[model samples]
Target: MGTFKIEGGHQLKGSIQPQGAKNEALQILCAVLLTPEKVTINNIPDIVDVNKLIKLLEKLGVKIEKLSKSTYTFQADEVNLQYLESDQFKIDGRGLRGSIMIVGPLLARFGKGYIPKPGGDKIGRRRLDTHFEGLIKLGAKFGYSREEQFYGVEAKKLKGTYMLLEEASVTGTANIVMAAVLAEGQTTIYNAACEPYLQQLCKMLNRMGAKISGVGSNMLIIEGVDSLGGTEHTMLPDMIEIGSWIGLAAMTKSELTITNVSWNDLGIIPSVFRKLGITVEKRNDDIYIPAHTDGYEIQSFIDGSILTIADAPWPGFTPDLLSIILVVATQARGSVLIHQKMFESRLFFVDKLIDMGAKIILCDPHRATVIGHDFKSTLKATTMTSPDIRAGVSLLIAALSAKGTSTIMNIEQIDRGYENIDERLRAIGAKIERLD
Candidate 1:
């Protein structure tokens, strides 16, 4: 239960670089199991989740070397399959949600894979049906232990086949794609997730000798190969963190530059903020957010209806960012409805915002209506506890813009996703301190 003590109402300046995409790193790291040759990955984020995954891989006997701060070389030639069945593995694998991805590659190359029920955010019910079903479609045998809450998949040889996914789940698509790459025949996947991070995974796998087409679309075609070779890959910048910085700049009236954001990959995130009347400018591969001297205003629909920002699949606004958007709307000039359609409990943190004197109506577990104060009534600092990763950062942003000192507990939630957030915030002149 770490805490953050923030002195609010401080203006920030300077440029901050976004960390490598954590989701992409998770998928790419798991792919190392597909090959025995050395694979070098650059731009890996140093967040808690990613570091934990790296430790898990090291325990499995992968030869890992640190080339630099964000670079690593991995060789899976000496992987220990016996460790997967150990009690220690059950504890390590179940501690992180990303552990579920390891099952795909392990089942493909090693004939079998097992994992305990993976754990992560407790925002809502995140079922593993998509992952298991996709593998089963690719001719892998699935078994579950109800009492132990463990999952296992086995296949002497996977046979690729055409199948349509029930939902365009990103991790599910990645899992199925990984297995199919080593199958016996051609495989076609429909309704596959086409998020930029998923596309990165497919591209990386292709670089490692997998035949995958439809790189940026919902449909994927894979031609199975006997084995994969090593490849060098780099991760994209974290768009969710980029979006968070944008919201933070607007809330605190900071002129901030987010460099190397990979503009083409940020699909519609900028325009979504523009809809909230925040100025998001493009200055060559970087995002430049000028201080909001005059508070921003929310835009209404052309038909004179209240504006609603909701989450959907790829190319749509991401659910991970709805919390930051909702927090930014607190000081804007108008009202907007934030609909977190993906998870039921993500919007529950709005009560803490309301406690800080922001005008918000919690319509339900997934909906909230925020009436901006237009900077006329600044939020008063209040003590709060972080419920999750995104919500924790939102609270931190609110504290930075409030009038008095604020305290936030459970900062480990924030640390799970963001790398060295307090240090990064300090580099941008933010008044924050960590209380151990």
Candidate 2:
């Protein structure tokens, strides 16, 4: 196990570049199984989750070669489909939620796919029914084993049709899109998740001969093709990491510049941060946060009262970023309510913050009210363990603004999403040490 010891009460000042989106890279790598040609991917983050997925791919007989630090070439011309039924491969598939994405490409190209229960943050009950439902709409039949907790899908030939997903599940949408691209007819997906990550996946599939329309909208129209060729693609920068950095800078009253940020892709992040009184400047593709920002008061209606920051589907605030925003609100000038509508237990971590001298009201399992201290620096660091990827980063941000040193154990959760996090924070004047 690894841990992070952070000495708090320091103003971070430097420029940091965001890594490639972990979610997008995972799906894009799985898309390689749809074709037999060599595919090259650039700007892939060297993170634990990506590494695990690559290991799974290699075990499936995909010929992989590293071209550089952030580049790799993958050829799946001879992938052994038999490995999908092995115990070792099933264990590997349980590593991350992204592993479920392989089901679509495998079923589409090889006529069958097997995956164990996918593992990820235990925030709530993330159901895979959405994934299976969409695949079934595309002519795939599913079988499951309760004892082994494994799922299997088999289909001789997929015939595309209209699919109305129950929810805009991101991974579910990605899986269906990948499967539909090579089906027998056109597939139309309604209420699909069109986040930037999904957009990147669609664009990459299009470059490889898949016809997809409405790249950034809820309704996706995918025209099936007989075959797909290999092409080179680059992953998008991690917006979740960029949001975490913005929160870190604000909580510590620091000045930081984030480079290679897609300013145009940030649909509602700027306005959402503006509501919390954080000023972000965009210079070309970079974002600059000024030092010593006078934290703004939480906005309200005409009656003048506290407002709420809540999460919703795409085009709304992202659920993945709600943790960071809640932690940042702890240092603002006033109080605001944060509602995490998507997950049931995500708000439970606020109890840890209250123990660190933060004034928080746990309204329920999904909501909380946070009162800022105006840079009081009253929190005394203590030993804590990371709960999930987003909450783990939130705890690190809180620890960075505390009065003394704090230790966070089980940092593998943090490593799943953020790439070279300690190194990037160290470059920005944060005192963080990784220990075994």
C-alpha lDDT values of all predictions? 0.94, 0.90
TM-score of 2: 0.98
Task: Give candidate 2 regions above 4 Å deviation.
Answer: none
Q: What is the TM-score of each candidate against the true structure?
A: 0.99, 0.98
Candidate with maximal lDDT: 1
lDDT over C-alpha atoms for residue 48 of model 2: 91
- lDDT by residue for model 1 (233-276), tens: 99999999999999999999999999999999999999999999
Distance from true position, residue 375, model 2, in Å? 1.7
> Number of the top candidate by TM-score?
1
Question: Residue 255 deviation, candidate 1, in Å?
Answer: 0.7
